[model samples]
Structure formats: C-alpha cells, structure tokens
Target: MTQPKVTLVVSPRERFSYTRASLESIYANTDYPFDLVFVDVCSPESVQTYLKATSQSFKILRTDHYLSPNQARNVGLRYVLDHTDSQYVVFIENDVVVKRGWLTRLVNCAAETNASVVGPLTCIGNPAHQVIHNAGGQCYIKTDFKNGQARRRIKQSAYLTGRAVADVRDQLHRTPCDYVEFHCMLVRTDTFAMTGLLDEGMLATREHIDFCFMVAQTGGEIYNEREAVVTTDTLGLASNKAGLMARFGQLKLPDFQWSDLPYFMLRWSDRWDRASLDHLRQKWNLAEDKYFTKRYAGLGSRRHELLIQPIVQYLTFGKGSPWLEKLLISLERPFNNYWFNRYAQRFEQS
Candidate 1:
C-alpha cells in the first residue's frame, strides 16, 4: 500500500533548550517517511548552530524576532501549503519526543477513520512513557442565562491527567474527542480549507483549544489515536529544579538556560496571557465568569513557578520561603513587563 505523504512542522513550545533532544527523538523513533519543516524564532546561538548543522536533513525556517506559538505554527503551515502537496501536516512542538511507530499509528488512524485531525497519547516528565499529560479531552463553550444576560464560558478538560499510563493503557483506543493538544497533533492538510491558518491572536495560551474548537465548528472529525505516543519533557510539576533534583539520576532534565529567559518570559508574560484571553473571549463571545477570573488572577503563575521559583530555590539554598519567592517575583514583574513591551515594539517595527 502506498503511504500518504506527511509533512511534520515543528515549532518552539516554550523553550529552545530541548531542541536537540526533541529533534533527535523524532528522527530516531519515527520509522515512517515524512518531510520536516522546523520553525526557529529567535532561538539562542547554540540552538541556531545545531539547526544550521542539521539543515541539510530538513527545511529550517528562521525568524530574527520571537513569535508566539501559534504564529510559529502558522509560519510553517503556510510554507507547507504553498510549497508542498503533502496530504497530512503534523504540528509537533520542539519539546516533544516521539516513540517508535508513533507517526505510523497516527497516519493509520486518520486513514481508517477519515479523521480530519489525530493526536497521540501524550505523556510528560521522566520515565517518559509512564506518566500521562493528556490522553484526549473536552474543549467547548458553554452558555448560561442569568439576569437576562447570556453568560458563555469556555470549558476544557483533560482525560486521566497525571495518571500512570499503565493504569489506563487498556482503556485507551482511537476515539473521537472534543480536542487534543498541539504538543503533537496530525492535521489533514485539506482541513485548512475550512479552518484557515492558526489564529495568531492566541498568543500565549489556549491556542490548541481554540484551533480544535474551530475544527469542530467546521465539521471536522478529531480522533485520539492511543497507539501513537509522544512525551514532552517540560510540563506539569516535573519541570522545575526540585523535580530535577528528585529524579537526578534519570535522564538529564532539559535545561532552561539563562538566555532563554527573554523569550520564555515574553511567551508567558501577563500581557500576552491577558491579550490571548481577551481575544479568545471576544472571538467566541465567552463570558467573564469564574473560569476567566481564575485565569486572570493567575496570569503570571507559569513564569513564577517555572522561572522565579527555580532562581529563588537556588538563591535560598533550596530553602526558599514563600515570602521570599513572592518578593522576588514582585521585584521581577516590572522587568518582565518591560521586556514584553519592548518585544511587542520590535514586532511592530518589523
């Protein structure tokens, strides 16, 4: 049987430190033939050198300025659409590692089910195959009427989050799901005819849910292919220094270099998060309820936990107090805002 032509477009997730491992894993594990288009947006010199060295093996798209996750994906997606006649385009983040037969399974599932999109069982952290990050889930807008006001809320849920993969292995199968994450997703190229390019307005978060919602709205079928598996090394509670220390003897944790701070900070900045949330709400007419309020309150939580806590722990000799961490984060918040604003200016100028 002839295999369908697949083009895998890899874009940065949150950091550039995992580029080597993630790219190597894809080439090492995936047996099926596919074209690769890597989008590199302002990655550090080390990562740039690595991609340069490997350029002959795949197409590398570089940008001098940093781009949001969806923007990067769209950069590669547009290239694929304009240049290639591939049937399927898989959007895989730069931090994800694939297992053997992963691509084959995703292709087979899409072929068998005629699924417009397919996602694998994505696991997280060390012992990469054991812990579940997301095994398909729900994402939709819900509406409630109160005081003659129609309140619309965006509802999202991940199945079996943090569960051991072994525990739910038997229950897993290729099935329809409301949404799957962009950490690793196989999308039929023709589906773009209906959904168009990824919405760049989803700058910092919820881009996956927004894209999946758009697909569903366009009568596209999305499936979760259980047999195909991939793991992201930088999610959940396991990405911090303490988590790394706890699992020290295992595989070396992907480093979040000091240079990664600028892009990382801007990527999860409060301004970007608020902008993304506001855009999503306005685009979908979602109401500002508890869901949105909670998100608004925790806009800086990701940068705090991932960037600040690690520095605090190092400075306090692993005994960083909550107050000290909070104080440090307070001191750092302005710098983050400045950096993001500067970045936005640069983007606008470009």
Candidate 2:
C-alpha cells in the first residue's frame, strides 16, 4: 500500500528555545513518510545554526524579521501549495512534542472519515501525555438582538481541558468537532482554495478559531482523533501553575532567557492583541460585548505576568510586590513598544 503524501509545516509558537527538542521529537516519533517545511522567523543564532545543519533533511525557509503564527503558517502553506503535490498539510508549533503513531493516526482518521481537518488530543506541561490541553470542543457564533440591533459573538469551548488523560481514556474517540488548536492540526491541502490563506491579521490570538470557522463555512468537516496524542512544553511552566493561576490568581513565571524577551514581548503585545480582536470583530460582523471587553482588558496580562513579574520577583527576593511590578512594567512598556514597532516595520518592509 502506498502512503499518503503529506507535508508537515513547523512554525514558532512563541519562543525559540524549544526548537531542537520539538524537531528531534518529530523525527524520532513519526514513522510515517512525509516531507517537512520549517518556517524559521528571526530565531536566535543557535536555533538558526541547528536548522541550517539539518537543512539536508527538510526544506528550511528563513526570514530575518518576526512573523505571527498565522503568517508563518501562510509562508509554509504557500510553498507547499506551489511546489509540492502533498495531499495534506499539518501545521504544528515548534513547542509541541508528538507521541508515537501520532501522524499516522491523524492521516488515518482523515482518510477513513473524509474529515477536512484532523487534530490530535493535545496535552500540556511535563509528563506531557498525561494531562489534556484540549481534546476538541464547540465553536460557533451566537447572535442576539437588543434595542432592535443584531449582535454576533464568537462562542468557543475546549473539552477535557486540564483533565488527566488516564481518567478519561475510555471516553476518548474520533468524533466531529467545531474547533481544534493550532498546537497541532492537519488540513486537506486543497481546502485552502476554499478557506483562503490564514488571516495574517490574527497576530496575537483567535487564529485557530477563525480558521476553523472558515472551514466550517465552506462545509468542511473537522474531527478529533483522540488516539493521536501530543503535548506542548509551555516554556517550562508546570501544568499545575495554569490551574492555580486561573483559580486563585497566582502566577509562576517560566524560564525566559534574555534573548527570548524581544520576540516574546512582541508576540503578546497589547497592540497586536487589540488589532487581532478588532479585525475579528469587524470581519465577522461581531458586536462588541463582554467577551471583547474582557479580552481587551487582559491584553497586557501575559507580558505583565511572564516578563515583568519575573524581574520583580528576582529583585524583591521572591515577594514580587505589586508596586514593584507596576514600576517595572511602566519602565518596560516603552521598550516593548519600541521593539515591537521596529519589528513590525521590518516585517512590513520585508
């Protein structure tokens, strides 16, 4: 039996430090025959060197300027669409590690069920396969009328988020779903013709939801293949930290090296988040409501917690006083703005 032709496009999710681990895992776990196209966007020297040395194994496309996750996917998608006869394209992030038989399971699900898109059971943190990030869930637009005005809003949810995979192992199965994350997803290559290139305007968030919405609009089916498991290493943040942060508003900072500061800041910048949300609102004719309001208000939360809080903690001997956090954030805001603007300009010119 001849194997299906597939192309795997790996792009940066947020940081470059996990590049080697992610790439090595792909080669080690995946026995399926497929081509690889890696999008290297302004990664550090070490990452660049590693990709260069491994260039013989796959196609490496590099850019000196930074790009959003969607933009990076578009770069690889365009290349695959133009140069290769791949029947399917899998867009995986640089930090996601796949388990054995992951790619084969996704391909088999798509082939057997005729799903236009297939996503694995994505887990998070250390002991990567034990806890679930998302198994698949609901995504749709809800419309309401107030004061004789129609308003539309995006409604999304992820199933089994934070649940231990061992507890729900029997409940997992292949089923249709409205949304799957970009952490790892497989799409029929020809489906791009109907959905168009991923919206580059989704610079900070909602890119996955937007893409899935487009696919559904075109009458394409999406499925969750529970047997295909993968986990994301979220910058060394323990899995429990996310739960604690959500429930009690506690934060444990991840390991962010100095070299990662610029890209991390730009990727989670308030400016990009606001722009992406605004674009989604307008493009989908969504009305401004509490969803947008909360999103807008929390735009700087990531940078504040991940970047500023760490410095404050270090200086204050682990106290991380609120006042110190505020002061450092004020001091860092200008630099963040300047660097992101400079990178944006470079991206535009490129």
Candidate 3:
C-alpha cells in the first residue's frame, strides 16, 4: 500500500508546550510522509525564530497581521490546496499534539471507512485518568435557569465526547453529527474543496459546526477514531482575560433562536454555563443573555423584564435556578464579596 501524504496545517500566534511538543511528536513518530505548513498569523517572527533551529520540511507563511481563527484556517487551507498535492490534509490547532501512531491510525480508519473527514480523540491526561475533551462536536442545549436548577440531564457531549467506545459507535451508527472539532480533523482534499473552507462569518466559535453542517448537507461522512488520541495545548492564552473577552464578545448570535441556541450554548458554554463559570471563578459578562433580553424587550415592560430576568439572574450571580434568586437576596453581600475577590484576583493576574 502506498503511504498517504498528509499536510499538517498549524496556525500559531504565541508559543507553548503543545506547540513544540506537536512538532517534535510528528517529526519523531510519523510513519507516512507528510509536510508541515505553519500559518503564523501574529508574531510570525517569533515562530520563525523557533523554526530556524529545526530542519523539518515545513513552509512558514507569515502575515503582517493576525487572522481570526476562521480566516487563518481558510488561509492554511488555500495554501495546502495550492502548494501541496497531498492526498489528505490534517488541521491541528497549534495547541494540539498527535500521539504516537496517531496518523497511521487515522489514515487506516479513513481508508477503510472511506470517510470524507476523520478525527481522533482529544484528551487531557496524567495516566491517573485522562478525561476526554473533544471526541466530536455534539448538540448543545441551552437550559433555562429553572431547568438547570432542577438538575435534569442535558446533552453532555458537544458532539459525542465522554461516552464509552460502544456508545460512540452506537451514536455513529445512528447518524453522523453536525461536524467534529477542527483540531486533529482529517479531510480528503477533494471533499474539502467541494465543501469549501470554513465560514469566516463565525470567525472562531461554531465555525467548525458550520463547516461540518455543510459537509453533511453534501452527504459526506465524518468519523471519530476512538484509538487515536491528540492532546490539546490550550496554551497560556486560554487564561488571558482580554483574549477570552475578544473571542466571546465577537461571537454573533445565530439567525434561528431556539434552533441554534443549543449549539451556541455548547460553543460558548465555557463562558456562559453557570456551573462552568462558578468552578473557574469566571464571569461571562452575560452578553448573550443581555442581547436576547434586549431583543425581546419590546414584549412589554413588566412581561419583558420577567422573560429575560432568568438570564439576568444568571449573569449577576452564577446561578440560574429560581432558588438562586432567593439565595442571592438572602446572601447578597457575602456572594458579592466572594465574587469581588475573585474578580480582583483575575484582574490582578491579567
């Protein structure tokens, strides 16, 4: 069997452990032939400095300015489509590293399954118990404050993440999801060209969902390989307050309200989910709620206020249940003090 040629597209801004680790892992373990394409969106000079020390077969495309995630990906796709004649293109966020034998596993799965797009498991690990992160994108359901407080079960997977291998297989047997995460996604060059690049409108969040939606609309199958693992290098920037705000603030609400709210919540759950925010001592600024609240405010002064207050309640205090309202009124000062300290700590660190 001929070795499949893969082009690895990396969009890097600043550097981190996963950046260097990804390159090193690929250089050391790749059995099939592959070329690396580095899209340096910001501070290409910094990346070039690091690249100077390595002798890998890579093409560094430096831009004077930074491209948003979606744009950078599109740029990388164009470069791969134009420069490399490789059969398959693998898109890995700068922070992700492929495990040993990862490419062999993905390629074998793709060939045998004839899947248009394939992805490996994404996990955070320590051998104690590596928790799965992004196995594939799943439907996101934005629960109401009451619903959340009730502690009802919601769709856990962004697509199909932490389920056992059998559960994942069963879901796949039923229907392919909207799309998998871009990180560690494998695509056939032809299918990629046919579907086209990611939607620049999204910029970052939900872009993958939009892309996958198109691919599935065109009758392409996206597969998740259980055995293959890729580690996501969120880098230090994930903790950056300004970066987080910019990423979340720029997210435009989808056209359909209830239809897309689930996915919207999924993509931005890091910022919007109450449980997630409380755990991190983070504040999402409740922008989404504010938007929806204002949009439907015309319903009536009292009625509109009542309708949107659920979201407001979530924003002000990291709780969404009606019980949280009572809890807030009873313990406002203490809760405020706690959040005040947390806010100060986050700000000071930033």
Candidate 4:
C-alpha cells in the first residue's frame, strides 16, 4: 500500500520544539515511508536555519510573506497536491508532541473509516500526564456582558470524550461537530478540492471550526480518535483570549450586578477599553474602583479568576440575590486567600 504523505505547516512567530519531536517520532514509529512537507509562513532567519537543519530529509517550502495560518494552510494544500501522490495528508502544528503510534493510529482510522477529516486528542498547557487541554472539537457559547464587557464561559467540548475510537466497527462514521482542532487532523487531498480550502477570513480564530463545519455540510465525516494523543503547546492561549475580545466589542450591563463580572472578565481583554472600566464603576456604583488595581493585588493576573466570578456567584446564589453579592464583597478576603493558596505558584511563575 502507498503510504500517506503528511504536511506540517509552521507559521512565522511561533516556536517549533515539540513539533519537531513529534515529526521525528512519526519518522521513527511509522512502519511505512511518508513524505513530510513544511510550509514556512513569514519565518525568521533563525527559524529558517532550524527548519533547514531539522527537516533536511523532508521537502521544505517557504512563502515570502506571512499568510495568516489559514492562508498558509491553503498554500500548503496546493503544494501537497502538486508534489505527492499519497492518499492522505495530515495537518499539524509546530508546538505539539505526538504519542507513540500516533501517526499509525490516525492513518489506520482514516483508512478503515475513510473519513474525510479525522482529529485526534489535541491537549495543550501541561502535557506529559495528558491532562486534556481540549479534545475533538469545541463550541463557543457567547453571552451578553452587561457593563461593556464580553465573556466566554465554559466552551462545549461537544464530541468524543475519553473513549478511544476503536476499529471501523466502532467509528462514529458521521458525527456532528462544530469544528475540529487543526493542530492534529487528517484529510484526503480530494476533500480540499471538493469542499474548498479553509476560510481565510476567520484567520486565527474559528478557522478550524469553519473547515470542519464545511466538511460536515458537504457529506463528509469527522471523527475524534481519543487514542491518538497529541500534546500542543498553548503558549498562544493568552493571545487567543486577547484576540476574541478585540474582535467582539464590549457587552453592556448595569453596574455592580452579578452578570457584570462575566463580561468584565472577558479574558483580560477588558484592559483595552477605558469604557469597560467606566462601566465597572457606573454599574457597581463603586468609587474609583479600577480593574487593574484589583487584578494586580495578587500575582500574575487575577484576571481569569475575576472573569469566573459570575459563574461562582451563580453557583452560590442561584438567582437574583442582592444579599449574595454583598456577601461576596464581604468575603472577598477569604476568597482571595483560598484561591491564592491553591494557585499561588502558577501565578507567581507567570
């Protein structure tokens, strides 16, 4: 059987340690030979040297300008079709490490199921022990933020959980997913031609989701292979949080209300808008209470904790309870202490 060719694209301004390890692991573990393609998007001189040094055995191509990840990906798709006759192409990211047998598992899943797109476990942050950063696909649940703030609560992981995708018999065959993470996914070359390349407009955010959505709409299957674990470095999560807030304007809410916090904590994006700070004061009816002042009280940024305040309030207060809000205000010290004890090390390190 002809082994499937794989294309791993590395964007400019991104680190490439774990990904190199992953590719090296693939080269060592796979039973058959596979072509590796590297699409360099606005890579720096240092990165170029590293890529040339590391990827000597594989085909490497570089673009002059930075084509946002989605655009770079389309360029890669074109390269793959033109150069390789392999049956499948796997799109992977730079800062990821794959588990042993990861490639064979994904390809085997693709062969047995013939899925147009197949995704494996793409966990981020702390890897090794495999604490899930995210699995399968994700859903964005947007809510109204009262004081010129926008908030993102717990996103829906939606598809496959812990259960591994067995053989063809156990394949979901066709599962409805909002989007699959591009960090680790497989696609047939024809699928790109048939459904079209990723929507470059979405760019950094929601591009993968849009791609998977398109695939599903066009009668293709998307599967989550829990067994094929890949760990991604989430060094970009902070930037991703900033990007979401920048794209969406602030949510307007009345002052000092429980819902206000959900918006204010919009992943630290609230720092950009002075109006959001004004909203915080006007709604809470407080005197000159600044978000930054509160944020830096602890280590790192109390930003994330502050964002989830509404969720905690909801869990504690149930519904409309003026008294609960007041109680939270009074118990602020204890609450801070509890959280500090739990997360002090991470924040200090950050």
Candidate topping TM-score: 1
What are the C-alpha RMSDs, in order, of all predicted structures? 3.2, 4.3, 14.1, 15.3
Instruction: Output the worst ten-in-a-row residue range by lDDT, candidate 4.
Output: 252-261
Tell me the spans in candidate 4 whose CA falls farther than 4 Å from its real position: 1-32, 137-178, 234-350
**Would you list the clashing residue pairs of candidate 1?**
none
Model 1 poorest 10 in a row by lDDT:
244-253
- lDDT: which is higher, 1 or 4? 1
Q: Candidate 3 on 233-345: residue-level lDDT in tens?
A: 33321222112112354432111123322222222222222333232111212324442334233222221122233433435442456665545444533443455355446
Which sections of candidate 1 miss by over 4 Å? Answer: 234-254
- Which pairs of residues have clashing backbones in candidate 3? 95-233, 137-158, 137-159, 138-158, 138-159, 140-262
Residue-level lDDT tens digits of model 2 in 1-350: 87889999999988888888899999999989989999999899988999999889999999878888999999999999999999999999999999999999999999999899999999988877989988999989999889998889878778899899989989789979999999999999999999999999999898888899999999999999999999996565563243222225444344444677678888888788889999999989998888889898787777776666665665666665888888887887787788878887876887
CA lDDT of each prediction against the hidden true structure: 0.88, 0.87, 0.56, 0.54
Task: Give the top-scoring candidate (lDDT).
Answer: 1
Question: On a 0 to 100 scale, what is the lDDT of residue 307 in model 3?
Answer: 22
How would you order the candidates by lDDT, starting with the best? Answer: 1, 2, 3, 4
Candidate 2 contains a number of clashing pairs equal to: 0
TM-score of each: 0.94, 0.91, 0.58, 0.56
Q: Supply candidate 4's per-residue lDDT for 119.
A: 77
User: Ten-residue segment with the worst summed lDDT in candidate 2?
Assistant: 239-248
**Model 4, position 344: C-alpha lDDT score:** 39
lDDT of 1 by residue, 224-338 (tens): 9988999986543475755333244432223657677788888889998999999988999998888788999998998888767776666666787899888988888898899
Task: Decide which is better by TM-score, 3 or 4.
Answer: 3
